[model samples]
Target: MEQANIQMTEPGVSRADLAKLLAQALGNEKASDVVQKAASKLGIRRDPLDKGQALSVLEQIAQTPGLVGITARFAKSRLHLR
Candidate 1:
């Protein structure tokens, strides 16, 4: 699959927007948990993440090696990665 190369510094989707999409994909409760885990793994130091941090976390998720990563990469493509 061809994934968009989103730069860490580039502005992407908002945290709330990403959470909403994730909620739709993985259920309401799992959304926050996924973001938290991704953020924690990426060393993001805040809640209500800034766009860059959110993108960083999303990128981390996309790189994860498993079915989750495949799902995440597919979802990442749906986001505005500009």
Candidate 2:
């Protein structure tokens, strides 16, 4: 089986940064809804997502198939992992 190239974001990533990246990747109007749904689905609490939770949301979107996933991967890449 071919392993997928999953890129991980750095720890301590701020919520604002993640939200900005998602907005850039998807769109300004849709980012909030998407994050809300993703967090709910992932069982993550709302209001100020911690580093791990934010990363999880990013990874979830990244794994989604189609433009959403592709764009998320691109956005995820912009984050500093090291």
Candidate 3:
């Protein structure tokens, strides 16, 4: 399969919104107590993430031996890089 390039920036999706989406997708709240729990469960950093950062983090995680399959399922067109 050919590789797809994902841009970290989107013209319509705000950075904060992307962060929130990822949090929800992983079963967490945005900038709330539940975020800590959800992040810990996912074994990712607990720091607040903006849209671009969230994309970068996701890309890195997708490269892991077991994470790509699961992450790919979350790659929707509305949020994909152009």
Task: Name the top TM-score candidate.
Answer: 2
- Using lDDT, give the best candidate's number: 2
Rate residue 51 of model 2 by lDDT: 64
User: After superposition, which runs of candidate 2 have C-alpha atoms over 4 Å from their true positions?
Assistant: 1-16
Give the alpha carbon lDDT tens digit for every residue of 1-82 in model 1: 9999987664445556666766766676676678778877877766666666666777787786775566566667666444
Ranked by TM-score, top first: 2, 1, 3
**Alpha carbon lDDT of each predicted model:** 0.68, 0.71, 0.44
TM-scores, all models, native as reference: 0.61, 0.66, 0.32
Model 2, C-alpha of 29: deviation from truth (Å): 1.5
* Best-to-worst lDDT order: 2, 1, 3
What lDDT score goes with residue 64 in model 2?
A: 80
The 10-residue segment with the lowest total lDDT in model 1: 9-18
Q: After superposition, how far is residue 7 of candidate 2 from its true place, in Å?
A: 27
25: Cα error in model 1, Å:
1.6
Residue 72 error, candidate 2, Å: 1.5
Output the better candidate (1/2) by lDDT. Answer: 2
